[model samples]
Target: MFSSKIVTFNKINFLNKLSDGFKITNKSHREYFNLGHPLESPPTLRGSMVVEFKMSFILDNEEFFEYGSPVDIGGLSAGYIGLENYKASDLKVNFFDFDKIISEISAVRFYERQKFLEHEITESVYGILKSNFNNDLADFIRFDENPHSRLFEFCLAGGYKINEDHVQKIHIPNTYKNSLLMKRISDRFKGRVLTFNPKYGFESRNVG
Candidate 1:
């Protein structure tokens, strides 16, 4: 049962998705700095960005939730509609490991689909990756499942430096090498490299 999925949408877009019945299980701050990124610059400074998080578009429509992004959106996204809890906050302050701050802020939760049989979690998760990020930068963020620890394996992996809104360019990280889950699109990446926590793309969220 996939309780939640990773997503990237601003508050306005998020509200629209919610109008379509997408419930937010949790969310990550749209502001983040990739590892090795100078701590002096965070995400918020770049204005006109979207809100990204873990979400599930299922209330009574589980089918809508499952085969939508990969099948319907057609590689426009990746990752399971997972969960995270990040309240409204200011995206300033720099020169520190944001992993610590994000960890402190996120109280992740999943809005799983009803599971009838016991399927291997890895395949399902991996499948989502392949469906969503088959051709893109799948080698970037490979931290989805490690099998031992059950938590949101949030890592600043591979992403793009899109120049949107003209505020400046942004580093939008993909989830992994298999799936560039549009799960999280942060304005943070002024870049992605370096691991403050030693383990960058090794763990995963055990949603069982």
Candidate 2:
């Protein structure tokens, strides 16, 4: 049901092409993913925005077949609705998978060490992996939150590459790293929640 192809992972070259605001078609086992416009129908993309379909094969499961690429890393799944019925974080007990919710909160975004060459552009699946928690419910909407930093970090680490945590500490761009600092100043204010929104050309405006 998806068009699959093998492509090289070039950090700057790729992101330069992927300007911003793209849709992903995979959730679990994100091995085969499609990037394209939100309005396009699947299977047959007429003027498909699908940038490319890539498979980062593993050489006998030991190393990535592609020089600096790694196997597909998974992302957080949007939980089903009717969550009020879930009582607690119990794997067998909670149908909502509450225990997994805790893991989602603490999940660390790391990558395979062997796939990268100590210092090379990697991938932004880290942010994808980090969507378990975010500034907004992007999983439900399937939107990328830290595109600016994702782009910046992609330059430093290259797409998804980073210095192994053991080798060098990660230096996140100020946009994402200090994003929470504003909340410190924000908690002081209590305002009405936005309840009305109107769709505009590409972008939306809060008409409430």
Candidate 3:
């Protein structure tokens, strides 16, 4: 279940708010980030951390939607455990405008350009998508590595490394455009993994 009220926030306060972690309940489609559950749970999320927010560029662009599908441009997601799996170059945390980076990395090809936009998940679900997308394991984890289906074969007894080619194809952020913001994010989250932002605290969608 989700609250019908739309949440809002600005980049500045949002950055500050994330320093304190939070939890979201009833998240759908991000079972990977929840710490203690057996992977059998469905795509729906019981709860998840809001480590990263993928702001929807399209939300403000009605023109873009006129010609293209009105996709739920972006949403929040977790980046803790999954981030560690990425190489420094792949992570590219300090080299991008968060919005631009996610857009490019999750280009149209990965998503069904038209009908896909109709289905949207909560911030927690988006967080799961973010984690997998950033870590370059979206496909592998979703299709090939069904840890639940093959618990012994994959989860307990198997191991694999990230495919360099796959990671190479993902987008790299442009640090020049937003270095200061990137620095703040990187510094605040440095050496910290598996943490998330509070679902409701500082302010969501606050305006002065």
Candidate 4:
């Protein structure tokens, strides 16, 4: 039953067909990055920018008490809706390798290099190519920057570089390819993503 559907939310925008509701300053990651540092981090899962909707569904079925409780403003907007046929398997990442990289790199070098690398990457010299990929992932997790593009930009952020050749070699998993909801404007996913309404009940559109 839980596997069949997932809940998500969006900001009300003039262009949104289902855009309706009062906006609130949820302490999610989008605001975390947007608001900058020296602030208390909100206890929320998934930042606003990464998934423009609440993803408590990820923890909904856990046996632990209130695992997914106190989600922000659910059912408040027409744009606030549920996704049908959601699956965790659809989301993939080589987190094992990424976590390994995160652990292996020296803290000094990781923090110092803040610029994206421009050189071509090969399998043999992949480890030598550096631009703080680990720290960038940390920022992405803490902040709501658009995800590092797997194709064109290659780098995780400005200096965190990963080329096509090295990406395949390292087994850097494509995380968002099959996700039903990513930033719709980013062109990361094609079309046919669906949303459900809580108002009149249900309506879906191909969000391209």
Error of 4 at 21 (Å): 20
Off by over 4 Å in 3: 1-92, 95-98, 105-208
* Structural similarity to truth (TM-score) of each candidate: 0.18, 0.16, 0.20, 0.18
Task: Please rank every candidate by TM-score, starting with the best.
Answer: 3, 1, 4, 2
Considering every candidate listed, which one attains the maximal TM-score? 3
Candidate 1 lDDT (Cα, 0 to 1)? 0.24
- Quote the lDDT for 29 in model 1: 18
Residue-by-residue lDDT tens digits, candidate 1, 115-165:
101111233443344444432322222332321112222122112112222
What's the true lDDT of residue 91 in model 4? 21
| Number of the top lDDT candidate | 3
Report the candidate with higher lDDT, 1 versus 4.
Answer: 1
Every candidate's lDDT: 0.24, 0.22, 0.26, 0.22
In candidate 3, what are the lDDT values of residues 62-165, reduced to their tens digit?
A: 22221111111111113223323434234222213333433533454433322122232323334445563542444333333223211110010011111112
lDDT (0-100) at residue 192 of candidate 3? 31
lDDT of 3 at 133: 54
* Candidate 3 displacement at residue 142 in angstroms: 8.1
Please write out the lDDT profile of model 2 over residues 1-208, one tens digit for every residue: 1111221223323222232213232232122221111111112212111122211211111121111111111111133222223221211212123224323323433442211111122334334334433323223222333221111100011222111111111111223223342232122221311111211211111122
